[model samples]
Target: MNALRTLISLVFAALLIAVGAFPTGAAAQIGAKSEVHTEQVQARLLAWAPQGVATGAAASGAPGTVWVGLQITHQPGWHTYWKNSGDSGLPTELQWTLPPGVMAGDIAWPLPKKIPIANLANYGYEGTVLLPVPLIVTPEYKPGPLTEAMDIGLKASWLVCRQECIPQEGEFALRLPLRSSTALDGGAFEAALKSQPAELTGAQQVQVAGERLQVRISGLPEAVRGQALELFPETPNILLTAATRGDAPGPRSWTQRWDGAVWTADVPLSPDRADSPADLPLVLVTDDGQGWRADATVSGAWPAPAPVAAMSPALEAALAANAARGAAGGGPAVAPPAAPAAVPAGTFTWALLGALLGGMLLNLMPCVFPVLAIKVLGFARHGDDRRAHRISGLAYSAGVVLSFVALGALMLALRAAGEQLGWGFQLQSPLVVALLGTLFAVLGLNLAGVFEFGQFLPSGVATLQARHPVVDAGLSGVLAVAVASPCTAPFMGASLGLAVGLPAAQALALFAALGLGMALPYLAASWLPAVARALPKPGAWMDVFKKFMAFPMFGTAVWLLWVLGQQSGIDGAGALLALWVALALLLWALGLAGRTRWLIASVALAFGAFLAQAIGPAVLRGAEPAALQAQAAPAAGERWQPWSPERVQALLGQGQPVFVDFTAAWCVTCQYNKKTTLANGEVLAAMDAARVQTLRADWTRRDPVISAELQRLGRSGVPVYVLLAPGQAPKVFSEVLSAADVKDALAALKS
Candidate 1:
């Protein structure tokens, strides 16, 4: 009987151990319920109600309303989300269980800080936050004694994230003695309430079109104008966060500016949302960390979408970082504000006129002189036929205008696609320069009577027919533009710069006007019978003149080859010369007869292919030559340094005056300035005395940075001179530089 009783006791002990080890679902549930009130469940996040009183009464002064606070403390590096969690994350949620006749209001969130995780940006809070909630007490509540109290229970759920995320929930209860009057001190909760964005008091207007939203506010203090400020949208799904415009406008971007008493902002709406709400909430924060909240109403009809220009990659990256910083409630690097439409009223007209004048001046440039001579000879051939001359003139004008338009369109298209190109950008390519050089060489040989192209063609193809005078004139116009591109004459810079920034249609019109101006002289000469009669009759002298013209063509070819060498190095230039030789040999073989000619042509073609294969990679690779480096390096006693965006910014930051020369070796105007004005000892002496930084931006080869800078300055080509005085907007000088110009700019800096 004793052994049985001991065995039964052992069995009872084993059963008790099993019950403790594997509890029932209901028991586990009860334990979890009890653990909700404990602070140790998730140490990373803690939720509690701050000790406070019903702050007298609500704005309505009703007995039913009382303001309270729910405080949350997060561990280091851990954070909870705001109403709108940018990029990713969920917002904190709270559910309240109250007695009869009691209600809870929405959480009044304070301004959130931007939390960046790798490349992703989020809006949340770190450290401690107090969320204010208005509790409504009904009039039916009876006045209670000290032991009688009101029970307020809150169930809080939040996601705490630091590199990883953990979901946490807690139940909190607060017991407060019933009272008619309550005293609440202005502590953390009061400070948080003060930090909340205030409702906008002034008139506000919002405009929305497509994905863009713009807001204008009036009655702002004049002092706020030009101050660094950031905008935050409280409306979820409308905007994740407002991007500070800083100085430069960005695509799908936000920018704000205060115009004296009124402030205007341009905000890009989310692409995923449709139909903007009539009412919007916004928070405006100054650089000093002060914030104001306001609700704005949409007013005005949606405007049509404006054409958006592509921003440079560098600017885009900078703006993105700026936006992130702004979201994080940090001061962002501001760019100089976009100068109020540099092209004002009547500016377009002036630009068109300038383009015309510049185009007319282009005729006097050395590059265009060769083409002009050919046109003159062609004119002599038709001096007697007034009708034919008139028709040819019209055809030539059409060709010139159409070519300019085409070139402008191509440039605009490329710019839209983010190509940092400018005037004569085609010449930046070694292949283009080579092809142009070869064409000039062939044309020179043709003019020198080396071989007639007509003889090589099958038949019915007139190589140089005077009967088709219109065609001849049109071809002449094409040639004129080809050579004219390398030279940027007076008035061209400003006009082209303006054109580059204008609408495509307007830009094309400006280009056409320039072409018309260039063609005007020839057009007038052709149309006017008296001018046509003044020309000397066609004679053997014409042949002599044509041969004379071949020398200039050859000269142009040599210049192009030199330019190519500067771009592709000496070895690449040598390869080009060999290719030219092979091409000449092929032409010679074509002029010969029978199997021997075919064999020679075959051999020439093979040699040309080999040369091309050898040179193609070198040209395409675009390796900077040692010679370029030597040229870029400052010479002894020279004050000029190579231009770089960083160096410019550094000098400007140090309050040093800078004189930048945007130039290229191939640009005749650039070369002239370098030799005549920039190289003058007096100018150099003045620059040295004034301690002005001189920078030379060489555009001999395609540099996207330089190209983008030029675009920013409203220029499309070389020979741009800018004088940046300390703490002042850059003063642009005329493309044609002079000693007086340099001295005046320096004197202005002193003033």
Candidate 2:
């Protein structure tokens, strides 16, 4: 009886330990048999299957391949990335622990969707997706029954994203009976295989030039050709996926076309990576969720795309029409060009030369004259010190080069961000114009001996620092660039246009060349002692010249005021004049104030504040109305209608020739052309005879439509002459127009 009791207690203890070791739920699951593993992760439902691994001949017969699949169902709005995740995101990863004698192939990626998030575009999949993997089973593998199944494990990790992203991972196991016969049907696997990109039916060709890739695909369906398509490169770091867009040929973008049966695309490549043109792997996807895989070969050398002269007339017309439509909608109209062909080594050399010539000519423009005069005076002062003169020259050149580079970078950055800004974009703002006007007025007053700041300074220090070569030279460079904004010289158009589309380093080099050109004359004069000596000696004559220089500053101020008046109406101009008066009074009071300087300064500040408060709103409000009024009225008997992109398109569509004068009131070059060439009686008569529909795009005010149109024409500033003949690409003329040039263009139109 005692022995029986002891055995019972031992059995009870053993049972208790066993129950503690395995909880009821775990124990039940361990005993449960299943062929597949499924789990719900953070943002996705995942399932893994060793679907085709079967017992008998299927496993023990001659070595064969088995298909395994991981099916992931994303939560609504959540997605997993493709092999190439554009802009940002990570692709899914799978690691397997297969039985010995089994080898796994790469995941067979299905077609992915282009997922746009905010301003960025990503390639990914939404909803349910199955990733298929093929496994090779060796003949050495043993067959198994349902009770003794083969174990296959998978470690899967992926990123799922909505507005935010979540990383998820799971370890999954599958138990499958080894079989002698193949499994003919796999539900999810079959579907996944169907979704795989089909191989292209015909030959594909790829051409690489500089940072661009062009692909020619033959034998595509018409429906697929007409629809918007996206290209996915299997090779990483070769192309910019985010830069992809619908095909429109230009200078620095991706464009695609379907020429009836064959499809062609010019794609922008990543500048940071070098890729061979041979055997490019690509997948082309349509908007309707169909995709075709194509392997392209490098058949021959791909020449860089030629300029507009080589473009087809029909294509040019179509691009122009698109611009017109965008203008009509009051949106950005300039379509980015096709990925620019690699510029030849000689091309940059020519561009640099053009930039140099243009910069040298820029010194002659009316707007730059005042600053140039100031610089001449500075040179005269530094004439006695050779070292100082050289130093000043170098400093001036540095300033000019740095400023150009900075401005070019800003323009490029803005363009990249989709802002339709161009050269002299700063002048388009009335506030900038007003500020510059004020500065010019103050400088003019100082030069004219009105309340000199030097008078208040101690005599010794004032005399000692009267002329700072470095400061004067640097400031002169700044002033030169500021005034030069309103002028675009000959050769400047092509050079600047090319620079804007080139790679960043090349573009910057072009800007540097321009600056070097502008500063060359001054630099040469300073460095050559003979040239410096050729300048007149410093004397009372310089004082007279200095005072005379004030006149140009006043003139510039007057011009800026006029531009301001055009931007803002008469009332706004009056407000600016009032502000100027306040400034003058403040300066006068400061000069006269002896003991009560603080009190006078306070009063002046209050008066300025009062004026700004009273007039600021009116000035801001008047700008739009002024622009509208200008648009409504054509200059009296001007024989030119106000220009709109819509009007240009209509006239072109009707087979009538049109001449566009892109002008601004502040642009001295424009004013000169208007007075000299455009106003010539013979030119007017010729146009009249040709029945040319004259259109004036007045850019005196901030006009987005005109701005976009200028950019579309590859110009950044005013005084652009565009002569459009019926059914032909428009001819862009020089900034400084001549009667003969206008006549010749018109005669060509007639012919």
Give the number of the best model, judged by lDDT: 2
What are the lDDT figures for the candidates, one per model?
A: 0.65, 0.67
TM-score of each: 0.42, 0.41
User: TM-score of predicted model 2?
Assistant: 0.41
lDDT of 1 by residue, 337-362 (tens): 22223455587888889999888988
Q: Candidate 1's error at 312, in angstroms? A: 25
Range of the 10 consecutive residues with the lowest summed lDDT in candidate 2: 1-10
**lDDT per residue (tens digit) for residues 362-474 in model 2:** 88888878877876787777667889888878878877777778878888787776566667777877766776777777777667767665555466545443445465566
